[model samples]
Target: MNHKRSLVRRTAAVAAAGAAALVLAACGGNGDSSAGHDGHTSKSPSASASASQGQHNAADVAFAKGMIPHHRQAVEMADLAPSRAESAEVKKLAEDIKKAQDPEIKTLSGWLTSWGEEVPTEGAMDHSAHGADGGMMTPEEMDQLKNSSGKAFDTAFMEMMIKHHEGAVAMAKTEQADGAYAPAKKMAGAIITSQTAEITQMNKLLGKN
Candidate 1:
């Protein structure tokens, strides 16, 4: 009977040792990099929620969302003169427009970031709100401008850009009146100032044409 009891105790000890070994093997024995009990990678739920959260109030969001397409058309007009223009003045104006507004686009982009809102990267905006502001040029207009050269190009650029500028000014006025955030409001004022000066220069050139 004592021999039988000793044999049973030995079997139980071996079973326990085997179970522990199996557990250890599962914890990265075969060069698996993940080794901890909490090995699955996941962001904290709170952090993910905050990532998508928008910081701006509705008014601010509307301004940024509205302004993106407005800026893009300005860039398009600025870009047209280099290939098609004969005049140094037209080319210089295009370069100036590119330099001035490209940074403003970045500035507005930073505004979106600080506001925790997505910048309207897609060039789709409801054009009904533009109100005599040629925020986004028609496909027909683009096609017409594309086919043009020299004097015609300058004419198309000036006409399109002046309308575009008017649109931007309207948006800026709305932002100033409605936006509470100081940085955004300041940007609106700056846009009005800089673009107004550029508009005057553009008008002067147009008079020559």
Candidate 2:
């Protein structure tokens, strides 16, 4: 009878050990699953951040590089208005142009810097050569603007600015269609809207509408 009891006790002990092992295995599996879930959650935010920073294409790069010099020329033209314009309306329009474009130039530069692209220097690119692309004023045309004052300056400013805004609209449209970067595309859309309105206003001022 004592031998029989001893055998039963040994059997119970083995069963208990087996049960404990099974519990431990289950706990280990759950722990690994939890760790995997946490790792996946952590990676999701990283992916989102990378997406928000945006991915640039060739068109996006071109838009930023080209717009910088184009904006610089517009700012230059607007700068002359304060000193040379005869009409209060013309002076205000120039101020508005400067206010709108200066920040845009900085934004474009920042995009270039972030993309590992070269930022164009102010007044470095010949505006005249860019006339086919950005409706840039030739050196002579700018010289004429600089030399004029009063009513003549206002009329010239209105006409030239209208053309310049039209060019910007064209570039912005191209960017909107072809650029890959989200921020750049958004900026391009804004340029199209604002510049189109400005073009209409300038035409009215020029008595062309």
Candidate 3:
């Protein structure tokens, strides 16, 4: 009876050991799966952000490089409003343009710097055209604006700024379509919305609406 009882205890101990080993193995398998899932979750966003930051093409570069000077010119034009503008509304509109565009100029510069592209110098901006498509004023046109005052300044400023804002909107649209950087594309969208609104406002200010 003692030997039988001892044999029964030994068998029970072996069974318990087998059960514990199975539990441990199962836990280890689950731990590995959980770790793999966590790794994948962490990597997906990182990979997406990396792609967004690095995937820009020449069009993106052009957009940033071109916009810097464009915004600078707008700010310059806005600066003339305080002294030259006859209407309070025109002055306020100019102030609004400055408020909106100065930061955008800096943002465009930052993007170009991050992309290792050339940041356009103020003196080097192209200014020999006019239209809704990236239009810029010639030196003579800018001088004419500077030389004018009172209602003439207000009218010229409105007309010139309306054209300028249209150009920015065009550039912004191109960036929206082609820019790889998420931040840049977002800025582009913002530019389109704001500039389009400004264009409408300027048109109304000019009595075109």
Candidate 4:
């Protein structure tokens, strides 16, 4: 009887916690720190988060190298939505993605700076462009997306972004497996968690989730 009663209590506690989480999401109390230096998230780091904290292997550097373009595409997509999306939810979500990620891109730049790694001149020199799922777009593809109209734009965005996110998840998985630093590993886990949710959100918006 004691064991049964304890199990019941634990179950009730879990259910209550889940309900509280739902309430928070519904209230738009979404909070994350370590997002771009905006109050939108609880913790956004600075652009100067230099990468030279210590020595790292080629794998960790490669992860950062590849992820930069992956993130850049995400920011580009988010930036495009203000003019493209008709749905308020989509627009709001896009704004949030840009605000959160723009600073993160800089944080990664800081890491590259500290590590004596060369940041890409623009969004080109994409590591993902070669292999990582062809995880990035060509300039022509980007142009096509830019000129796409209405629901056409929405459809393409969801399809391309879902694929894009999968590539980031792959990179994060690699980072977790091989990174020499704690911060890199932690950020990789965070990317996996955050992008998984955002991809789901995008799918739901497209009525595919």
- Which window of 10 residues has the lowest lDDT sum in candidate 1? 34-43
Clashing pairs in 1: none
Best by TM-score: 2
Residue by residue across 87-190, what tens digits does model 3's lDDT show? 99999998988998888888888878877887888777675322347778768889999999999999999899888888888888888888777778888998
Judging by lDDT against the true structure, name the best candidate.
2
Which residue ranges in model 4 land beyond 4 Å of their true spot?
Answer: 1-54, 125-134
Q: For model 3, what is the error of residue 59's alpha carbon versus the real structure, in angstroms, after optimal superposition? A: 1.4
lDDT of 1 by residue, 2-116 (tens): 9999999999889989988898887646456654423533445546545654234566667777776677667777787899987888898888878877787787777777767
- The backbone clash count of each candidate, in order, is 0, 0, 0, 4
lDDT of each: 0.75, 0.88, 0.84, 0.75
Query: What is the C-alpha lDDT profile of model 4 across 1-209, one tens digit per residue?
Result: 99999999999999999999899885554354324435543332432233434456777788777777678878988788879866777677778767767777787777878788988667464553438464676677778779985788777777777777787888889889988866778788988898799789988988885
Better of 2 and 3 by TM-score: 2
Local error of candidate 2 at residue 71 (angstroms): 0.4
Model 4 TM-score is 0.69
Candidate 4 clash pair list: 32-42, 33-43, 34-43, 51-111
